[model samples]
Target: MNEYIQRCEALIQELPHDAVRQNEPIYKHTYTQMGGLADLFITPTTYDDTQRVLKFAHRNNIPVTLLGNGSNVIVKDGGIRGITLCLKHLNNIEITDTQVVAQTGATIIGASREALAESLTGLEFACGIPGTVGGAFYMNAGAYGGQIADVLERVLVLTEEGDFLTLGKDEFEFDYRKSVFSKKQYIALEGTMTLEKGDVVQIKQKMDELTIARETKQPLEYPSCGSVFKRPPGMFAGKLIQESGLQGTRIGGAEVSKKHAGFIVNVDGSTASDYMNLVRHVQEKVNETFGVMLETEVITIGEDLKDPVND
Candidate 1:
């Protein structure tokens, strides 16, 4: 047997207690409900298991891809190579006074709800965001004029070297839809958010208002990668798409949402290529119309589907 094959088998045996599946379909894990497979999809039961898996992958030179809630990522049809570490089982949210601590796998919505339960005021903006805490920190996720940068206190990240490091919010170099964790390729384990003690009624009211607004505006019923494009310099991406007449534009099964121009929805069974192609088309049309090049907020990973060879 080849050394790589030997390593794969050995790693599986090492993590016997973890939920490890080989050549597993990843579509079910993502919000968009489309993907190919993961060579080794692992959901570690404990933090120690996470560390051990990382150490093993590092020592064996096996690439490890850390996924949070899979809310904003696309895995191509060719599938991912090596290990795919899903942190969904590590969900733990702690609240003390006005500060909230959330693990990587904990949903931002869940964290916000916890904040509301405690009468905290800062996370109300995130009550409708469909990403995990780690993802929110990685991308500085924002909505309703509030963002992670506004309340984040610190982050705990796991390095490629298998060491944990704590970084203050200021150290992240936070900006619109970006943070240092993405650039550094660090795996964020958790985040601390500082908030204000507020009246429960007011907290609930704000959260309810935002929830109603989100439900009213977004195409929440369909499978979609929430907002497909980043807001370009003082311009709303959805507005630009609407003005460009790209709404309801369909390529294969993927369509630019008529309800929300910023989102591309899977109206039928759509491949990653369909979504990708539609995104490109929207970018081209919007640029032609308004002279502003649009950037994507959604992330695509893995290889493209290869065309079949015929004799």
Candidate 2:
């Protein structure tokens, strides 16, 4: 084995055998079913285990990447080199009256369901979101006029120095598809969301309506990184793309969804490059047509191709 791989394996040996995997395929983990591989993939069962792995990587000067549910990201074909820590194994949810405490890996949908079970109202807007609590908080994910910022009370995160800290909603600096977590590189460990008591029937009705709206509007049948771009100012990204005559535009296997122009879906066996190229093409067309530049909401990472396709 090479030096880096050897070192990573040694570190993995110190953690639970089932928790650490070598040369793990990242494609299967992502919503788009695209990506190459991770050099070392670790799934910690608890917060302490996560810290131990992070501490080891830090001390050894090994690079570390945090992944959550892989729902809103596109990992490139060249793959991630250092250790990729996926928090899926840390999923745990607790309901205490009007509060829901969710581990980082717990799905936001699952948390919303827990809230519904407890007849809490504020989380109804999140029932259709397909991401983990950490990812949602990282991006300030929201829909149907509600956002994580509206309900999130506080979050627990691990700092770069391996220390745990609790941050309130204000500290998150929540905004449209952004949070302080993106800039600070703090790994979210857990979060507590506060909700108000409400009629269970009303909560379920709202969730159902949202779910139907998503099903009718989005191309959920295909693999995609949800919405491709953030809303540009007062204008919607999808409307801009649609108005630019870019809907159903295809570059290789990736295509702007006919149902929703905002999404670049894997119509056939699309690669990360195909998706990225399509994104660039749409951006160019939209910019030329309307003087607005679209910003991507989907996070793209990993090595760039040696000879990437022209955008």
Candidate 3:
């Protein structure tokens, strides 16, 4: 084995046997079923374990990648190098009255359900967001006039230097699908959501209504990274793409969703390259027609594309 691979294996032995894996396929962990292999994939089950792995990587000068539920991201075909940490095993939820404390790995939908069980009302808007608590907090995810910023009270995070810290709501700087987390190298550990007590029937009705709307509007049957581009100022990205006549435009295996022009879906064995090309094409067309530059909301990682789209 090479020196780096040997060191990775030695480090894996220090963690729980089942928690660490070598050359694991990253495609299985993502929503779009894309990506190559990760040289080292660690599924830490506890906060301490997460800290240990991060510390080890930091000391060894190894690259570390933080991955949540893999909803709003695209992993390149060349995959990721070094340690890719997945916190899915750290999932835990607790409710005390109108406050909900959720680990980073817990799904936002799961947290919303816990809120519904406790008859909390504010999280009904998040029941349909397909991401983890950490991912939601990282992006300030929102829909239907409700956002994580409206309910989030505080968050616990581990900084790049391995210090644990708690940040209050005001410190988060939550805006349209953005947070201060985007600017910092801190990893979210857990979040506390403050909600209001409401009638169970009313909350369930709202959640159900939003769920129906999502099913009717989004291309749920296909694999996608969810809303490829951010809303550009006063304009909606989907409307602009649709107006540019770019809906259902295909590049390789990736196609803009006919149902929602904002989404790029894996129609037939699409690679990360296919998705990016389609995104660029739509951007060019929309810019040419409407003169608005669309910015990508989806996070792209790993090596550069081998076959890039031609202009």
Residue 99 local lDDT, model 3: 95
lDDT of 2 at 51: 85
lDDT of 2 by residue, 1-311 (tens): 54557887767777888998778888989999999888888899988888888788888888888888889999998888888989998789998988899998999999998888889999888888999999999999999999999989999999876788999877999888889988898999999998999999999999999999999999999999999999988899999999999998899899999999999999999999999999999999999999898999999988765556663
Model 3: colliding residue pairs: none
Error of 3 at 45 (Å): 0.5
**1 against 2, candidate with superior lDDT:** 2
Give lDDT per model, in order. Answer: 0.88, 0.90, 0.89
Worst 10 residues of 3 by lDDT: 302-311
Pick out the ten consecutive residues of candidate 1 with the lowest summed lDDT: 1-10
How many clashing residue pairs appear in each of the predictions shown? 0, 0, 0
Regions of candidate 2 where Cα sits further than 4 Å from its true position: 306-311
For this target, which candidate reaches the highest lDDT against the unseen true structure? 2
lDDT tens per residue, model 1, 1-311 = 43433577876787754478877888888888888878888898777778887888889899888777788988887777788888888799999998999998999999999998998999999999999998999899999989999999898888887788999966999988888999888888888999999999998999999999999999999998789889998889999999999999999989999999999999999989898988999999999999999999998887776778941
